[model samples]
Target: MAEYRLKTPLSNEDVEKLKSGDIVYLSGTMYTARDAAHKRLVDLILNGEELPFELEGAVIYYVGPTPPKPGEPIGSAGPTTSYRMDPYAPILIEHGLKGMIGKGKRNQDVKDACVKYKAVYFGATGGAAALIAKAIKKAEVIAYPELGPEAVRRIEVEDFPVVVVNDTFGNDLYDEGRKLWEKK
Candidate 1:
């Protein structure tokens, strides 16, 4: 229940202050990637090739936005199911990714990675794509344009809303809520 406004690229201190269930309004830059983009990112890391963007302190949103309407930077940019990227998340986290925005729960490896890496996972509201799109001030395809909507895009956001689903301390909001409900 605490509310915080944070800017990226997030610092370790910034993530350490957060706890699961805290509401966060994030501003500054974030990148977009789905499963395909994530795989490519991991491949680049494994190959010791240059990545399209800097990974240190970076936040990646699990989204593939639809084509924008006139005068808009993006469209219907809701978070996709996060688990799809679970396979590659730990590697990215180990490499310096600091945050993630998506829906649903992440696997144990991802949660553990957060604790080990001082990273955090934020849950964006699903079915609120259009509303979320409003927060994106600018977007540009930075890599893998052939992936189309799944392409990696660099985006700037202003007060983009999210909730801390998993924190650097290995706390999980969904599990906490489940326990609370069971107690009730």
Candidate 2:
């Protein structure tokens, strides 16, 4: 495929076109959630309740942000490790969650869910909070505001750099990339 770059307001089809390792400049309203929020969401799922937002192909950023300063949309924001959310991932996938942005290795079930559901897992650079927050143009807490940093917020971002660490084809860049470099 040709080198493709996407802007905000991308559709599900637009998200679907993304491949592993494709550089992206994301700009749009992306909802933020993390491990605890995910647990609550999954609980609601078991209770046969509706989610706060339509997740079908919607991008989820795995982050719990620091309190934003006055006049700032959000505080420093960045991807947390994906392993913490492992329990609830498949459920999100089954519900049409097309992608998850986080860091570190995801569980096998998460990888399997990607294959079964055509989802992708992107890894934003770890510890790049200041730069990551810059991509967010706006922020609003959508759920669990009392959770403080773990609050679910709707954030709009632009040109957020990420690499596809895990692709739907069952490839893991963290492992594969390391194997290439760690050769004895």
**What TM-scores do the predictions have?**
0.97, 0.92
Q: Write candidate 2's Cα lDDT for 1-184 as tens digits.
A: 2245565444556656766667666667678889889999899888999888778767789998888899988888878988999889999888888778899999899998987787778889888998899989899888998888988888888888888766678878878778878958
| Residue 179 lDDT (model 2) | 82
Pairs of colliding residues, candidate 1: none
For residues 1-184, what per-residue lDDT tens digits would candidate 1 score against the true structure? 8999999999899999999999999999999999999999999999999999999999999999999999989989999999999999999999999999999999999999999989999999998999999999999999999999999999999999999999998999999999988953
Pairs that collide in candidate 2 are 8-27
For model 1, what is the C-alpha lDDT against the true structure? 0.96
- Candidate 2 regions with alpha-carbon error over 4 angstroms: 1-3, 7-16
Alpha carbon lDDT of each predicted model: 0.96, 0.81
